[model samples]
Target: MTAAVRDIWRHPIKAHGRERLAQVDLTVGAALPWDRVWAVAHEAARFDDAAPAWAHCRNFTRAAGSPSLMAIEAEVDEASGRIRLTHPDRPEISIDPADPADAARFIAWAGPITNPDRPQPARLVRAPDQAMTDTDFPSISLINLATHAAVAAEVGQELSPLRWRGNLLLEGLAPWAEMDWPGKRLQIGSAELEVVEPIVRCMATTANPVTGERDADTLGALKRGWGHQICGVYAVVTQAGTIRAGDPIEVRP
Candidate 1:
């Protein structure tokens, strides 16, 4: 069977918003370009700007804690280092996350949507030479559309794949086929990647991207139908190449 790329996505700021791409150039030993490259540290976070380093997800504001964040969509301008964010409940705003001048404005814009009980957003920080992914290591998440369909069917609702926050959405594969792919290599388009492990799901998957509301019980569906709370696999790029939508994914021996 030939699995093909259905969509490509990146979240420039961790758990803040997502951007879809038609094509991207992959680099060896790197996560998807600009994916989770920055994160918003909360007021109670321990991250030090002077000495930025890889910190745990708990240090940032995320969808799992604030479902409203899921409703955000992002558009990034790589050349200008600016990001434009839009949400259903708020006016669109654009800013350069690296600039200190725009930091306060960003926080105020997102403040209303965030959970009042959770630690409020304090600042935006990026560690040099690191992507703020959930995993300490740089990796890309590959999701099987078939498996997503299965989960949606089990839940008796149409779930958006965005809930999973995966980098690559693949189709034409059997449901849950990725579970057996750890330690295997896959060639997609011209890029090669090695499957690392299954992604253990979190509560973030229950939120609806359109409304940013926890309307679905994805965890319950996964546990009841599959006995595990995993929907995708993490992969590390092994070969540098450009990949595009419609690219065929081939299992490499």
Candidate 2:
């Protein structure tokens, strides 16, 4: 099926906020630039910044664990190496994540929004080379709008693509077609990406992006409708190039 780029998003801080983008440069064998570059480790987390590496999602303060985090929005100032964060209930704040004092400020601001019953946020951790993506390897998530519509239909509610927290959004593909694309190659704009695997659904999908409340049974809908808890596909860039919204996308066998 023919498809085209619909939207692009980057989360400079994992599970904290999202930033919309019009265009981005994809490098071969790398995750999206500045995406999930920093993550807030919880008080109980064993994440060591002196020797940073990928840990389970539980180590970080996530929307799945704290629904309020879903409502936050973030913008990154590349020149200053700072992120400006905003939430409906809180004042806008900018913090330079690399600075210890600024990181402490972020922790203070995020403490209340975090689930009190669970581990509290303590500090921010940065990845050594690539961003701290969920997958062990560098990858970008692609969500098909048609598939999202299908899920929304099954759940009987209007769902937002932001709920999936994907990097690239595509349109004009059949529902569930992406589930069978693990070995396929997609040519998007000037870049080529190889489908790596299907992205498994998590509780984070149930949270409303605007309200930061659990309003949908997205995992249940995916299981009942598709017999699996999967929505999007993860792909790794094989050819470095620029990608933009409205760029044509073609899948190759």
Estimated TM-score for each candidate: 0.98, 0.97
Query: What tens digits encode model 2's per-residue C-alpha lDDT throughout 147-166?
Result: 99999999998999999999
lDDT of each: 0.93, 0.91
Root mean square deviation (Cα) for candidate 2:
1.1
Q: What's the CA error at residue 195 for candidate 2, in Å? A: 0.5
After superposing candidate 1 on the true structure, give the runs of residues whose Cα lies further than 4 Å from its correct spot. Answer: none
Question: Model 1, range 1-253, lDDT digits (tens) per residue?
Answer: 5799999999998998999999999999889999999899999999988899989999999999999999999999999999999999999999999888887788899999999999999888888987999988889999999999999999998899999999999999999999999999999988999999999998889999999999999999999998989899999999999999999999875
All candidates: CA RMSD (Å): 0.9, 1.1
